[model samples]
Target: MSQREQAILVVSASTDVIDLIFDLCEQCQEASLRLLVVRNTDEVESVLEHHEISLAIVDCSTFTDVEYLNQLAAHLSPMSTMALLEEGTAEGMVAVLRNGADDVFSLAELHLHPQLFIGSLQRQLQRVRMIEEVRFLRESLERSLDELKADQHAAQQLQEKLLPPPVRELNHIDFEYVLQPSLLLSGDFVDSIAINEYQTIFYLADVSGHGASSALVTVLLKNMTYRLVRNYNRNSSFDIQSPLATLHRVNRELLLTGLGKHLTMFIGLIDERDSSLTYAVGGHHPMPVLAQGGEVAFLEGRGMPIGLFEKPVFDERRIALDPTYSITLFSDGILEVAEGDSLDEKEQVLLAACGGKNLSPQSICDFIIPAGRVNPDDVAIMTVSRV
Candidate 1:
């Protein structure tokens, strides 16, 4: 409600009191108050039924039963202001105020100095307006929060659709992964694709931040991988099998988008016939762990983060894979939730978990992020094995 807009309902049986209120309203021209004069309780009830009142001034002397005043105060809007005019002592004024009246003034004193009553009325009206404004702002904030949740839900659905399958079998190797975001949208992404009869490619990326902006880069990364596969099929010049070339292309394209964001990644290619695994790393922490012959250790490779440098060099390392071996990759978010006093201890815990024979995406999540617990960052884990 605006400051100038208010309907003042004045209830009094005495014509002289009604006339004095009208005179006071006229004298206080800046108040811009509208008046509704009622003679008795029955008239007050009738007016309240049909119209909304902002301020109600009741003459207590005119009411035969004070219980009716309580009922009238209850029926007024929660933000409405009420003042009582009574011909009584200070104790009577306190009783009237306790009964729901915001303020109470003696009729005798009002007749002597009407300005005091007018000033009190103005203050009560101002408080009422402030309450109304606060209520409106709270309602608006709730609506915005609801809209944001809906948008985040939609984005989450889209990101899920873009995710690679949780489990896949190609040739003699098996691929499985998990992607979980601290927020509704994830910054981590994983993909595995079969390029030919003898080769398959898989990669995991963790964008710098969480939520919508980082999630968008994951989409771009997916599209870039898809386009590279298409180009590899068409032209011999495009080399999707080389992990270093794939990372370099992704870095160049991401920089071209001008998103001002960077990501750590691990891209790898598997050869089914020769049992060879070649991979490159882009500043990813807790590097991919290779488990073979009851031993687990981190892969050897390091480079600058993608989309941050123009001519960054990434090293491609190759290792012979045993018939029964597993390679596990993770985003840094897992280290954040691991229970350890130091970074080395956390890495040891992860290495132990990765070396198990029955390592799965669900197991990794359950071990790192327990039920009823929240993660501080997006978590991603991918495992490729041949057993």
Candidate 2:
């Protein structure tokens, strides 16, 4: 696993060939260059254990058979290789090169053009070093990619864990929710927190983007709402429990953080004693559907998205709920799934799906939303019903 020192490997017993390599190394002034000397194929593996052999110089006079030279060349590669033969066998260069030697040289050429021969060796060595460097960089990049994936996976698990159960109880009300993500990290989130024995505050928020940046905002939203609940429990603030005040608190915090993320959300407070739902809307589209009195209609409320402006104002809306009622809330991703040519057409389809009497959250979503879509936008669907 350890990276080895780069070197040239010369496989020969002849003192002339060995001396030629030493002379070339000195003539090139490669003071740090290391040479690995081996006499036979048996010694090749042992030398490889210590040095990263970049170039192999094989004296092919004893390996004239094409098949044997081919085998030798195969063993020396992917390191650059050169074949040396006796001067009279000039025709051997073609066979050696075709068999995969990067270059071929002769003892006669080295003697006649010493400078040119050294130049050729230098070029081959430079090429081999470049190949090794590229391989090392590729491995390092792969390791970095793996680490990023691991971190994203951990963040996704924690995000899923923070969600409420599919079926949650708060006095006379019940809550249900489902989430689908476009990627390893999602921008959509939903949760419920009990403000008191009789009041449960629930909301679904869709942050501006997908992946880690938006995911961090979802975590902030959860923490902000919890801090508000703690304030209510300590009797430090009552407005903290109101859906309108909660949106205002979140908007202020988001602006202060300067994270450049904003979200559209619908927060509701279910008062069991009054059989009423008090809620606030932060520019959430396809507003929460109210299914009561054997009919379905979109709740009427509008406001600026949170985290966008400094003096932003939102309104608190109230609607009386029947003894048996269901309120379905969806992030705008529903429109992406709803069949339509335009936003108006998609809204109509969403309304039609909710016409049934007393449909559960899962039933409403299952009817309107298709599953197994590739690269779907982040979606959070939630329903609060009296049971």
Clashes of each: 0, 0
RMSD of candidate 1 to the true fold? 2.9
| Model 2 error, position 96 (Å) | 1.4
Ten residues in sequence with the least summed lDDT for candidate 1? 77-86
RMSD of each: 2.9, 2.6
Name the candidate that leads on TM-score.
2
Candidate 2 at residue 121, lDDT? Answer: 82
lDDT per residue (tens digit) for residues 235-261 in model 2: 898875688988999999999989999
TM-score of 2: 0.92
- Write down the lDDT that model 1 would get: 0.84
TM-scores vs. true structure, each candidate: 0.88, 0.92
Say what the RMSD of model 2 is.
2.6
Give lDDT for model 2: 0.82
